[model samples]
Target: MAIIETRKLTKSYGSIQAVRGVDLSIEKGEIFGLLGPNGAGKTTTIGMLCTIIRPTSGSASIAGYDIVQRPSAVRSKVGIVFQDPTLDTILTGYENLELHARLYGITSALRKKRISEMLQLVDLTDRRNDLTRTYSGGMRRRLEMARGLLHRPAALFLDEPTLGLDPQTRARIWDYIRKMARKEQTTVILTTHYMEEADQVCDRVGIIDHGQIIALNAPGNLKESMGGDLVIIRTKEPPLVKIKALPYVREVKFNDGVLEITMKDAHLHLSGLLFMIPGVECVEIRVPTLSDVFIKLTGHDIRDDSAEDSGSWIDSVARYRQKGK
Candidate 1:
């Protein structure tokens, strides 16, 4: 069953359309990744579903509650970890979870039990009493994850969960995420810049660009869609015409003096390709990655895009909470 569903969901900011006519049905307990370059509507779509930003057209529901009509219920069913940190530095990790539990109206006994389990789950039990101001970035992120899951929400939304973490820390975070999903059967909807991490953790990913989802599928399937082996050749002068004429060649793209060609059986054709294309300084044959898929579909590296257009929505959340106060 779909715990999250949307139809023609859209959010327009005056003359600028942030998210346009997005349709999605995410199954229960599924780990879904929303992949896109900056300003591609990934965050906007997430904001709408999380009820942080209202859609201008269409509708959506989370855990069977209408986002617009029953926003309180929707909020109760989902947990969110924004791209920007929102933790209170003055409070200890334990205090943070305690505050959230109280806000959710969790009974005293249940709240204590839940906080204990979450602290251990995130491996922060030892430092739970320490002020959050002293916590390391990775430790803080794990604490955020634990806090988000404290209420046992039906779904969790994470935006750039491991943006600045080291590789080992990132791996540990993903492990915690998987364990939580399996133990609680909670659906995870996250937006991330790390393609490899998404490919590893997500069961399916949606690639959005220009306020629309251009592709949605499992990582493997999406990468497979890029056709056969990817042969990247660094050449000032590429033999584009001859390469295109090859019957086995799937596609060819040249940018910044590098040729990215997808073809069948690269080992069989690399020698011939090298012979045909002059000034071939380098040759690399590898499988297609999520980054490659993004470049192929969007014509730009996901990292190359500027994030300025993707203004921070966490501030909006702060403002919303201020109103509630």
Candidate 2:
């Protein structure tokens, strides 16, 4: 049986349809990514799978336990590291893990051993006694990760695990995730707006938009679907619509005065397009990334909506745990 499975899984906040009908199956020890822009329903889907929010309709199961029919069993089998910080500011890092260990019913002896090992896994052994408020953003994120894995869950759900973290710190978190999946044989399902994170860390990615998944494939396969290199040009009011009609131009996009072309062959197409359109400077010529694929499928930039509510983002996890269920 698959470690995680969903059929027509969906959720609605009254009239707001956060997640449409979706079906998925994840194997043991696989890292899967749900990629999309803000309000693309990534968090809502993760919320349902993690049991923090009930689905409006449909069903899902993790580790052979139904999510709705067996929430406690599913919760026991999964751990979640949320998008925002959940560590207690006044508490020492070790104290945080100890609390989770106790909540999960881990024995005292096992708790000590697990806390030590988790600190080492996140490279925080030396600073275990420091107050978490004093720790850097990256350090806090790592601590949350360690806490999530303390119970040796069958599946780990990380929602924007590296958001607001530095590039170096994000790289380290990915390493820890990979190591856990390999040595411990854990299955992970993560959601993120960072296309590079999905491309670099996940074995498979599902591109979601408007409460639905538009595409699902490995990062390379999705890029390969682009067919050829891109020639992006920057000019005030460039006629991207006209460019799409040109030979060798597979697709054309104009965002923020930049015209991006998915070309059959950039070498054959660049010179002619450049000569035809004066005053347009070539911004870049390279293969498409996951970000490009999102744009190609969704017809809009991922961050088109302004900032998401930060308070709601962090509170989603903190509020759930504080309920003391």
Candidate 3:
């Protein structure tokens, strides 16, 4: 069953449309990723679904409650971990979870039980009493994850959950997220620019660009849609015309003295390519990746776009919560 659904969901900031006509249906207990560059309206879409930002048109629901019509009910069914840290520095990790539990109106006995279970799940039980200020970046992130799940929400929204962490730390954090999602049986909806991480962690991802969803599928299926591997050949003189003439070559581009050839069964054609093309200084065969799929669909690299939508969205979430009081 779909735990989260949206139809023609849109948000406009004056003339700038942050999200436009986005339609999605995410299944229960599924790890769904909104994969895109920084300014691709990933955050805006999440904000609308989380009830932090009202849509300009269309509608969305979380666990059966309409976001705009039943904001309070939708909030009750969802928990959010923002891009920036929202923990109280002075409070211990346990205290932070305790406060969140109380705010969610979880009973005392259930609160303690949930907090203990979460701390143990994230391997933070050992340092639960330590002040959040003293926790390392990854530790703090784990604590936030624990706190978000304290109320046993039906869905969890993670906005760029590992933005600033190092590679190893990012991997470990993803591991924790997967582990906890299974144990809690909560649907996971995350927005991220990290293509490799999305490929590794998300069961399915929607490729959002310029406030629209261009494609949506499992990572492998999307890569397969590209139809071939990439063979990057570096040389001073290029044979662009001849390369494109080849029947197996799907696409060819020559830039900065390097020729990128997309072809089916690259390994079989490598010898012929080297023999036919002179001045072959280097050749590398690479399997198709999510990044490759993005470039094929958009013409330019994903990172070529700027972070135009990088608003202080976390602050917006805070203000929305304050207004609820």
Q: What's the lDDT for candidate 1?
A: 0.88
Tens digit of lDDT per residue, candidate 3, span 1-325? 7999999999999999999999999999999999877778999999999899999999999999999999999988999999999999999999999999999999998988888999999999999999999999999999999888888889999999999999999999999999989999999999898888999999999998789999999998999898788999999887778878999999988989898888988878888888888888888899888876765665432225423333444323333444565
How far off is residue 150 in model 2, in Å? 0.7
The reply for model 1, stretches above 4 Å from the true place, is 231-284, 300-325
Given candidate 2, what's the lDDT at residue 241?
64
Per-residue CA lDDT of model 1 for 1-325, tens digit only, reads 8999999999999999989999999999999999876777888998999899999999999889999999999988889998888899999999999999999889998999999999998899999999999999999999998888999999999998988899999998899899888887899999987889999999999988778888899998998887889899999988799999998898999999999998987879888878889888888999878977876675442234645343434323333444565
In candidate 2, the residue pairs with backbone N, CA or C atoms under 3 Å apart (3 or more residues apart, or in different chains) clash, namely none
Q: Is candidate 2 or candidate 3 better by lDDT?
A: 3
lDDT of 2 by residue, 1-325 (tens): 5999999999998898899998888888889999877787999998899889999999999999999999999999998998888998889999999989999999997889999998998899999999999999988988998888899999999999888888998888888888877766789999998888789999999998778989989998998897878777888776566777887888787788788778876876677788767687556899778876776675432234324442333224333433554
- On TM-score, who's better, 1 or 3? 3
| Candidate 3 wrong stretches, greater than 4 Å | 231-283, 300-325
* Candidate models: Cα lDDT each: 0.88, 0.84, 0.88
* lDDT score, candidate 3, position 138: 96
Total clashes in model 2, counting residue pairs 3 or more apart in sequence or in different chains: 0
Ranking by lDDT: 3, 1, 2
Best by TM-score: 3
